[model samples]
Target: MTAETAVPAATSFAALHHRPGEPLLLPNAWDHASAAVLAARGFSAIGTTSLAVAAAVGLPDGEAATREHTLRLALTLGSEPYLLSVDAEDGFSDDPGEVAELAHQLWAVGAVGINLEDGLGPAALHAAKIAAVKAAVPGLFVNARTDTYWLGDGDGDGDAKDTLRRLDAYRQAGADGVFVPGLTDPGRIAHVVRCVDAPLNVLYSPAGPAVPQLADLGVRRVSLGSLLYRRALGAALDAVADIAAGRVPGGTTPSYDEVRALERSVSARASANSTG
Candidate 1:
C-alpha cells in the first residue's frame, strides 16, 4: 500500500477481531524508521503512540498538537507490510465531524486501524464519535479508549462503574476494540474482558502482568504504548552520560554499516514498490 495505491475494499476495521487466545501485540513506533524496523522484526501490526509523536514534535502530549505529524506518520507507515493503527488522542477536538474527517484521511492514506480516546469525556459523546468514525471509514478499526484508570475516580467502585459505562457505550457505537490503560489486575482484567463484547486491549507495562498471564486473563490486544519510546530515550541519556564520564557505552552498538543498510533497505523497497 502507498499514498495513491488502491487498497482492497473488503479489508475493513472488522478484520481486527482477534483469533481467540492469540492476541495482537501492537508495538508503538514514532517514525517511519521505527515502524519499518518493527515490521522487519515480524510484527503483524504496528500502533503509533501519541506521547511519542507529540514529544518528537516538541509539543505537549494529549494537547492535540500533532495531528499533522500523526497523519504524516500514518502515510509513511501505512505502506509497510503490516497493518497500521494510529493513536489519535481525543480525536484532536470535541467535534465528532472533525474526528470523522481525520479517520477518512487515515483511510485514504492506507491506514486500516485507529485508536481514539475519551479522556473522561461524556460517554455518549465519545460513542457518537466512534459511530461517526465508523460511518466515515467503515473498514478502519476504532479502538475506543477511556482514561478513567489513568486519571482516577477517587473511589475504586466508582472508577469501575465509569469504566464499564464508557466501554458499554463504545461497544454499542460499533467499536471493534476497547482499551483500558491502567487495569492490570488479572482478576479485574478478566472481569472487564467478560463484560465487553469487543476484544479487550490492555496497555503492556514493565511492572504489569506478563503476556502469558494476560492471555490467560483473556486480553485480546496488548499495546506497548510509549514504554519503548521512553526506554529508547533513557538509553540515549545513559550513553551520553557514559561518554561524558570517559566511559564506553555498555550496550551492543549496531555497526555503522548495519544502521546505514536500514536506510538503503527502506529506499530500495520504496523504489521497488513505486515501479511495481
Candidate 2:
C-alpha cells in the first residue's frame, strides 16, 4: 500500500505487544533489501540502526549526519509489509517541535513507531519532545530511551534517582515504552519494569541475558540494535581482507540475480497489495 494509507492502517501501540512467551526480537536493518529479507524470514517488525545509517553515509554515529539518508531509508522500507520503528538520535534537534516534525515525516512515510533517545539530553526536554510527538501523531508508538547508563553514571544516589525521575517523566509524557540501552543487571531490569507503566524495552546484546531470560525478567521488547549491521560490515571487511591476501571469500553468498530478485519480489508484492 502507499505510505499514506499503510501508516494509518498499522499505526498503533497494538503492534508493540509481545505474547508472554514470544519476546519481541526486533531485527535492525540498514536498507530496503535487508529489511525485506528479514521480513521474508518472518520478522514481524524491523528497526533502523543509527550506526548503520550513519556508517552507510560515511558519517559518525550519534552525530546526526545521516538525517536525509535515514529519511530516505524510511521512505523506502516504511511501506514494506512489516512494522517500522525508527531510531532518531535525540530527534536530531533539541527543539521539541522540530523533533515532532521529524516524527510527522516518518509517520507520513509509513512508520508506525519511533525510538527517540535522550542521549542524555535534559530529561524534561526529552519528555517535552515525547509529549509533542504524541500530540502530533497520537498513533505513533513512542519508545522513550534514556542514555543514563549508555552515556552517564547519574553520579550516585542522586544520579540513580535522577534516572528514575527521567523515566517517570517519559512515562507520564505518553511514551508507549521506555528503553535503557546499557542496562543489563537483571535486578535493575526487573526494577525498571516495575517502575514504568509502559512496556520496557532493552537492547539485546551477545553478553546480556538471553531472549527467554529477558522475557522472564519482564522486558517486553528486545532490539538487536546495530548487531546485524555491524556483522554485515564485518563480513565485508573479511571478504576484502581475503581478496587482498589472495584467498577466496568463503561464505554463502547470494548470486547477483538473487539479490536483484528481492527488490522485484517485494516491490511487486507491495504494489499488488497496494492496488488490490
Candidate 3:
C-alpha cells in the first residue's frame, strides 16, 4: 500500500490487542519516514503522536489545536500497508457529532483506529464522544483515553476508584479499549486490568513496566506515545552538538539514498496502482 493505494489487511487492527502474553507494542510515529521505517521493521500497526503533530505545526498538544494537521497526516499515512491509528486530542471538539465526523474522515482516508483522550474533562462528554464515534464508524477502533493518571493522580484508593470509574464509563459507551497514560505501579496496573471490562491500554513509561511485564499484568496494548518523537528531536540535537565538537555521532543514521529509497518505494507503489 502507498499514500494513494490501500490494500485490505489480513489481520484486523483490533486483533492486534489480544495475543495473550504478547501485547501489541505500538510505536508512535510523527511523519512518513518514521512510520515507513517502523512498518519496514515489522511493526504491523503504527500510531501518530499528538505532541509531535502539534510540535510539527508550532501548536500545543491536548488543546484540540492540531485537528487539521492531524487530518493532513492521516491523509498521508492512512493508506500505508500497516494499520494507522491517529491521536486525535479530545476528538478536536466537545461536540460528540463533531468527534464522530472526525472519526469518519479518518476512516474514509483508510485509518483503522483512533485515540481520543479525555484530558481530565467531563466523563459524560468523553463517553458521548466515544459512543458517537462507534455509532458513526463501527469498524474504526476507538481507544478511549482517560487523563486521571496523566493529570498526576497518585496511587491511592481515590485515584484507583476514579480511574476505574472513568474506564467503566468509557467501556459502557462502546470504547474498544481504554488508555491510562500515567499509571505505572505493577499492582495498580494489574488491579485496573482485572477490573476494566474492555482491553487495557497503557502508556509505556521508562519508569514503568516493560512490554513483557505489561503483558504479564494483562495490558493488551502498550503505546510509546511521544517518546520516539521526543527521542528523535533529542538525537538531532545530540548529532549537531557532536559535529560541532569534532566528534562523530554514535547512533545509527540512515544514508541519504536509504531515505530516498523509502520515498521511491511509495512512489513506485502509487505508480503501479495508478497504471495497473
Candidate 4:
C-alpha cells in the first residue's frame, strides 16, 4: 500500500469536515499500535501527536527536532484504514520552501493532512508556509493553526482579535481549515466560526465545552491532540504506583489478548503488503 492507494481516503477525509452537525473527532496516535487500536475502534481519522512522538524518542516537542520521526510515522501509518495527518510543528523549519517540501513528502507518504502551527511567529511567515504547502500539495488538507490563544495572555478581547487576525491571514493563504486551541469560551468560539470562512477546528479541552457543545458552536473538526497520549502515560504511572504500594490498581486495562490481536493485525498487513 502506498500514497497512490490512499488517495481515496484523502478525499473521504476532506468530506468528513463537511458533514452537517457531526464534526470529525480526530484522535491522535503516537505509533503503529496506538494508531491501529484507534482505527480498530472506528476513528475515521487519526493524527500523529508531536508531543508523544518527541517524548517517545526523548526529544523536546515543538522545537523542530522530530522531522525524521514524523516522516517515519507517516510512512508506517499512511496505509492504515483511516485518514492520517502529521503534526509538523512549525513545519520543521522557518523557510516556506522547506515546509512546502515537508508537505510534499508527507503527501507522498500517504498523509492526507498536515498541522502547521505558527508558534507565535510572524503572521506573514506562517501564511507563506501555508501558501507554499497548498501550492505544493493541494490535496493535503492544511490545517493552519495559530497559537495566539494558546500562547497569549488570557485577555479575551485582545486574544480573540489576534486569533482572528492570524486565521484571516492563513485562510487567505489557502488554508483548508483553521485551528484555535486553548479557546474554550462558547461565545468566543461562535464568534470565531462566524468570522472565518474556512472550517473551524478546536482542540478538545476537558475544561472546555464538550463535543456536542462544540458542534452547536459551528465547529467542523475536534482534535484530541496529545490528550490520549498524556492520559496513557498517567495511567501507566498510576498502575505502577498502585502495584508498588501493594494495592489493586483499579482502571480499565486492555486485555493481553486484545493487545496481541493488534500485533497480529500489523503482522498480517505486512505480510499482505510483502506478497502483494
Winning model by lDDT: 4
Q: For model 1, where is the 10-residue window of minimal lDDT?
A: 4-13
Tens-place lDDT per residue, model 1, 1-276, is: 644343442253344456677677889999877787787788878889999999987899888898999999998877777788899998897889999999999888878888999988798999999999989877678899999988775247788888898999999999989999988777778989888888999999878899988988889899999998998899899999999999999885768786788789778987987898
Task: Arrange candidates, best lDDT first.
Answer: 4, 3, 1, 2
- Candidate 3's residue-wise lDDT over 1-276, tens digit each? 332333244137888887788888999999999999999899989999999999988998888898999999998998777899999989999999999999989988888899999988899999999999999988789999998888955767988898999999999999999999999999999999899887899999998888888999999999999999999989999999999999999898999999999999889978987899
Model 1, residue 253: distance off in Å is: 2.6
TM-score of each: 0.92, 0.90, 0.95, 0.96
Mark the regions of model 2 whose C-alpha exceeds 4 Å error after superposition.
1-13, 154-159, 242-251, 266-276
Candidate 4: the clashing residue pairs are none
Worst 10 residues of 4 by lDDT: 1-10
Deviation from native of the Cα of residue 211 in model 3, angstroms: 1.3
For candidate 1, report its TM-score.
0.92
Q: Could you tell me the C-alpha RMSD of candidate 3 in Å?
A: 2.2
Per-residue lDDT of 243 in model 2: 99
Global lDDT of model 4: 0.91
Candidate 2 per-residue lDDT, tens place, 178-238, comes to 8888888788888888877877888987888999999998888899999998888789999
**lDDT measured at residue 67 in model 2 versus the true structure, 0 to 100:** 77
Best by TM-score: 4
Model 4 misses residue 48 by how many Å? 1.1
Model 3 clashes, total count = 0
